[model samples]
Target: MPQTDLSPISAAPGAAVLHDVLIIGGGLVGASLAIALDRLGLEVGLVEATAPGALPAVFDERNLSFAEATVNALTALGVMQKLRAPTGAIERIHVSRAGDFGRSVLEAAKYGRSEFGRIVVARDFGEALEARLAELARLRRYRPMRFLGLADGGSDTRAVRVADVDGERVLHTRLLVAADGTRSGVREALGIGVDEHDYAQTLFVTRLRSERAPDGTAYERFGADGPTALLPRGDRSFGLVHGVARAEADAVAALDEAAFLARVQTAFGWRVGRFLGCGPRSAYALTRVLAQALTAPRAVLVGNAAQTIHPIGAQGFNLGLRDALTLAELIENARRETNGAGFDCGDTAVLAQYAARRREDRGRTVAFSDGLARFTANELPLLRPLRSLGLFAADRLPSAQAYLVGAAMGYRGDVPALCRGGTQPGALA
Candidate 1:
């Protein structure tokens, strides 16, 4: 995390921007990847369509959950300490079904951890990423630019066609990374098809002010409409994500604050007390997008561009950060091999290694998120009793609680070095 003087724009106007690696997107994942590479003294270029700080979609507004492991990784990478916003800790999790007979509680202490995770607004996180990106002297940023085309593939040196403020430009690099969000242009240019599933659900997000303050606790209540989550925020307000059918989203959004609070109270009960006030509401259609492959020759995908899953487990962004960290570690080593002779950061070996190592983690996270979304929303009576039994078991049984707690904390199989409280290629930094 040591700072260095940023390398000047290595690529000239109307000429190829030459670098060790070129990132096609500069969102959270993409920007962090650039910073991680800069820490290793790699010449990196970030191509972003939007100017810094003014991001759209999930980049702002909503309160986001950062798995304990994810926060540790970002902190180790010098990304978290720079954030300016206040954050809350999730010391415990309460899970139950509306009007169900049983409930489950997962405590961080049960797993020998101080807290399960931390919560912060997307706006604050966006600001942190920008701050880090600005300090990366090794990174050359190309903003207000886009991936206009892909050229020089199937060649020794691959070049990406980009359109930016300098007009038509070309970026030649050993690798092209597609951190370009779900509608990824690089993914499309690579002809990489994605398996997408529309959950037919829309999530309404807002800040809730309850009469009784949350005590470092988070709740997930599953009802007929969908799953509702009340996450503890730093300001003592609860961040709420209420899922409803697509057809009902508009009607729900049109409801006034009082009516909306009433609906939430009815679904969640008095567990968290009365909903007093709430901020403006926003809604998002839920869908899962997984690319058929994680990498292609001279190109790779990371973050949301690789997989966009249901937000139930808070795994989407956490998993994406892993993708970035994992890729950075692999690339850092690749640069040292051969004593830097004809070193290729985009070598097939690196891509293959990344794809192999990420396969299990990606599969597990996607399955966990998708399964939670489907099962909790299923209205079948036969599943109700089973769900109740499962929740109660998690609450009562140590092994059951451990399993859920481990996953939520990002402590699953083959955890990345940073997540494990260790560093990979640490000597380089």
Candidate 2:
């Protein structure tokens, strides 16, 4: 992403730069939204806190599981074609619980899919986003800028105060978006409260090479402590997410490479061959953060600022991308309806429609992630039989398998047009 180095003229009291839509964050979701709106004939501005040539913490070494719908949306936005790194295909998923007799398997071939989705390293995806953003014809990027707070504005627009290297200035916009992480300043400025839940678990992510290269099958094994997942990667290694009790996380992290591999092998069993080499592990505390409302006045929330869910089902970024695409679709429709005569992007009806369209998808995704995280953590003996039976039913019954497949592929309510299979960039249908 190329950022302008010229110092911007400080706006006088009544003179301010205005945008059709101003996004507060430039992370994964925010950047995606900026790219979507770029093709829609809107004057867009992106506030990125990170300076040029430096990657944000969100683009760490962790691996991201993209649902099929997410893959389609990114491809449609021309982001996937810019990726420098190859992605791993998930052709099959195997799910089971420790000390249980039942197991479930989902195959993409059975559902007429070449693969459920592709897995990309977060760092690689971030680089792809930058490449795509650089190609946008009309996106204004404010790098190394900090959003101060909401400023005074008329009823039709919102005034946002921000500080850059030069100085502080106010920018006006018809729509304000909060794509910042779990703790969002824009949401706070809008007086939108959040509901939080701590899972009391620490997730460790890393990569491991086995005697056998991954055959495009992902494994999810749940134990009393937590769930351990291994996702296939393009480099002939498996991306690992291991969950452990918060109290025991440090000890697990301090283990020697051999010891760590052994523990994972014991927990996950020898589905693949023995682990040969392991990479450095990174730990993150698991928590679910949900905004009380999706919109307030002329502003709205997307990505983690809207809802941060457990990573058990690998639904965090996939759901957030859906949020971004849905909003972009709605804004595109509004612009077309007015024949480019300049309609209100922040009109109450537009925000209400966006909120209503997102409710079912967001609520169901949160419930699935949160419920799975809690359900697998409980080891009550009385629930053991129920768990086994549920797994059996899910594996045997067609309806249950179909539901799981739908969730896995992100075919939820009100999917955006660009999220459909084979959608081209800038397509309306």
**TM-score on alpha carbons, each prediction:** 0.94, 0.96
- Candidate 1: RMSD to truth: 2.4
lDDT of 2 by residue, 140-204 (tens): 88888899999888887899998887778888899999998899999999999999998889999
Best candidate according to TM-score: 2
RMSD of each: 2.4, 2.1
lDDT of 1: 0.82
Clash totals for all models, in order?
A: 1, 0
Global lDDT scores for all candidate models? 0.82, 0.87
Q: How do the residues 1-429 of candidate 1 rate in per-residue lDDT, one tens digit apiece?
A: 433232234233334346778888877889878877776666678887786546645576798899998888888778788888778899999988876689888888866888999998888888888777777655777777768878765576677777756566566888889999998989999899999999989999989999889798989998776789999999899999998899998999999999999988888888877889999898999989999999988889999999999999788888998898889888777767665666788889999999988998999999998988888888888998888888889889888887888888987766678776665344242
With candidate 1 superimposed using the best TM-score fit, by how many Å does residue 354's alpha carbon deviate from the native?
0.6
Provide the clash count, candidate 1.
1
